[model samples]
Target chain A: MKRNPWRDIRLHGTVLVLVVIAELIGTIKIPITQDVAITIMPLIYTIILGLAFYLIKPIKWIHRKQARIAEGAMMLFIGVLIAKLAVSSGQSIGLIFEMGPALILQELGHLATILVLPIALLLGFKKEAIGMTNSIGREPNVAVVVDKYGFNSPESRGVFAIFIIGTVIGTIFISFLVTFSLSFLPLHPYAFAMASGVGSASMNAAAIGPTLAAFPGLETQIEAFAGFSNLLSFCVGIYIVIFVALPLTEKIYNWLEPKIGRESIMPKKEDEEDA
Target chain B: MPDLIDGSENVSVHGIMNWIFLLAIFSIITVIGNYLGYHHPMESSIVGMAILSLITLAGVWLERYLPFNISSILYISVIGIILAFPGMPTSEFVLHYVSQIELLSIVTVFLAYVGIGMGKSWDEFKALGWRAVVITVLVIAATYYGAAIVAHIVLVLTGVPAA
Candidate 1:
């Protein structure tokens, strides 16, 4: 019942207006390779994947017993070792024959990226360097909200489910719209961040540069945006979702109170049907 | 290598199994991708994962399986690196799939994940926050530009065509 002031500011409102102002004013001269790789190509991938995989949940991934994880990992490792082996072999082979060092090195890099994630994560978190590991996938905001609601209601679950859908769709929708807009002007993620109020001014453009480079000539802008947009989105989006969702959570609490089998929060209303 | 079903204390048997299953589909897709080559890698990977997941889903619905499933997911991620290389002319192979895929969307996914991760690790982020986030974006953005800038400057300063 207490009002949260930040809710009224509308996080994006501040960031978006500044972004448009900046992009409209700034001028940039970009290097061609960076321009293409960072902006055009990456942006193209982002937009395309957004449309295709946006609705498809990323979390529900392949899960199986005795899956080929080790085999797959080993394959990746072997692929890397082969590349290193090829390096030595290809060197003598190339010097003796007339080929290139590119192949072996390329093979190694590819294998490395694929195989490195697990090892990297394991190493990265060797001693709880990252966080209070307990917080990995949990949401503190949601927990607090649940505690405040203090009722077990099926309707609450229903609303929360819808909220999940909303969050996902909203994320996707914003991505789609931003990409569409990106197609037109020489825009970047910085513009999106500033304009959308997602995170920082230039971050979005920077990050987007590589992804959208496929579009040609738009790489610079796209890469810049990636740098800032996501952070802004995270901050603003969370603030917005919490501010909006929690207040209505009471209704959610009431609706779900009856449907759920558990009784914990609110006292049950005892009424005589005969009366 | 840890077993697909089991892992060390740092990892878990349960978690390993889950990731292993993902790796299985990822491996299938990877094989398909290799066969398809750089061009159709994304498409092939997506299709392979989808088919595997769908079959798995059907099994679950039929009561022959369990539902704590990574019940549905698909992605075609690895091909980009293969497609992008110096001296290798932009072959029709590269051109074909590159045109179809949307790289920006993927970046957004990552950015969103980073955002979520930052939120999850608020303490870490708060300490570094704007400075770290900005620096990361700069480095990444500059990577695109830095490579070119360094190359260009090297050539200009040396009065040689770096190319």
Candidate 2:
């Protein structure tokens, strides 16, 4: 999802309609279980965008095409292998057999999974990686307003790093604060909300996956709650990010521009090696 | 995968009937199982993944025929769905998972055409152009500590011992 850069008119329009339909389902409160059926449109959007090119266009035996099919299979393999190993190792250590080697082995699978998730993600999103990634750092096109803002300026890049680090620190600080407050106040259980809140749902869940398994108790419950809550919140968060967050961010940028100075927002010249 | 695509060998494996057949079977079984209330037979995504993988292995090992691909689709789709929607319980995510799998599958095909424009910074966030990072951080912090303190505050107010 991160790498997609294409803005195909048909694809975008189709996905947009599907998302609208999905949102409408949520609004209607369908008994088909909004949680499950709500996924229909997003999935449909994704599949249509994906399979549409091949199914409708020149590629008839699309699935048989080596180039694309290979990548799909490769990704499927990586995701499955990581998930499979992580689960089997964890199960055997916790449920079936109790041995240090077995336990370590299982833990390794979990660790590897956490470490490689982002990379796997990058690979899977091969189509949009460029556009999406650029959309993040700089204006995708000159026509956009963020254009006047220097994407190549030093301050812009440096400030970006500082803010990201700050967010990470903030996420942890927030989690710790919650723990502290729990000792003194009555609070609603976060469930899976907090973990996803820390970052993306997949990320927090993967990172804490091992901890939750190894320590199964109230601690685990809290993580599960955080994971679950985060997952739900993530869906809402993405929309807010696109609509509310991005616009609000621009407003804040404009407000700060006079005081912060134009130079304050300039992104620094990055090394070619890094690129 | 770049190699696979760029490779000169053109030995093609037509999976049209295979794809249709497998998709049919997966939809049938998932729908029937879901309707029958075998919802979430596996407790966790991890466990469910393992179970499905095992079934996939069985199908793959059983024959070189179409069932392997069908099983593969179902297994991968299940994992993809869980990864995409972390909040969804396995029982509640049957159809949801299948759709994500197909979506991810399609996107994965074009991954090679893309590249990352990495920017150098003192940290991971360096080169990211945004002031709203502050709001992002602040909101996250507020939510985290806010929940924690309130939970504790309630306990103290109620005079319930902290477990």
lDDT (10s digit) by residue, model 2, range B28-111: 322322222223332342234334444334333333455443333233333433543333454234333332222222222111
What are the lDDT figures for the candidates, one per model?
Answer: 0.27, 0.30
lDDT of 1 at A3: 18
Q: Could you give the interface RMSD of each candidate, to one decimal? A: 18.7, 18.3
Each prediction's number of clashing residue pairs: 77, 46
lDDT of 2 at B63: 34
Question: Which residues of candidate 2, in runs, are more than 4 Å off?
Answer: A1-224, A265-275, B1-115, B119-163
* DockQ of candidate 1 compared with the true complex: 0.07
Distance from true location, Cα of B27 in model 2, Å: 20
Q: Measured against the native two-chain assembly using Cα atoms, what DockQ does each of the candidate structures obtain, in the order listed? A: 0.07, 0.05
Residue lDDT tens for model 1, A183-239: 654432333323332222232343344345434554554343333223323222223
Question: Residues B1-163, candidate 1, lDDT per residue (tens digit)?
Answer: 2243232222221233444353343334233323322233555445433332333333223332344532111011112222223233532344343333222222222222222212221232233223222222222222223222332343345453211
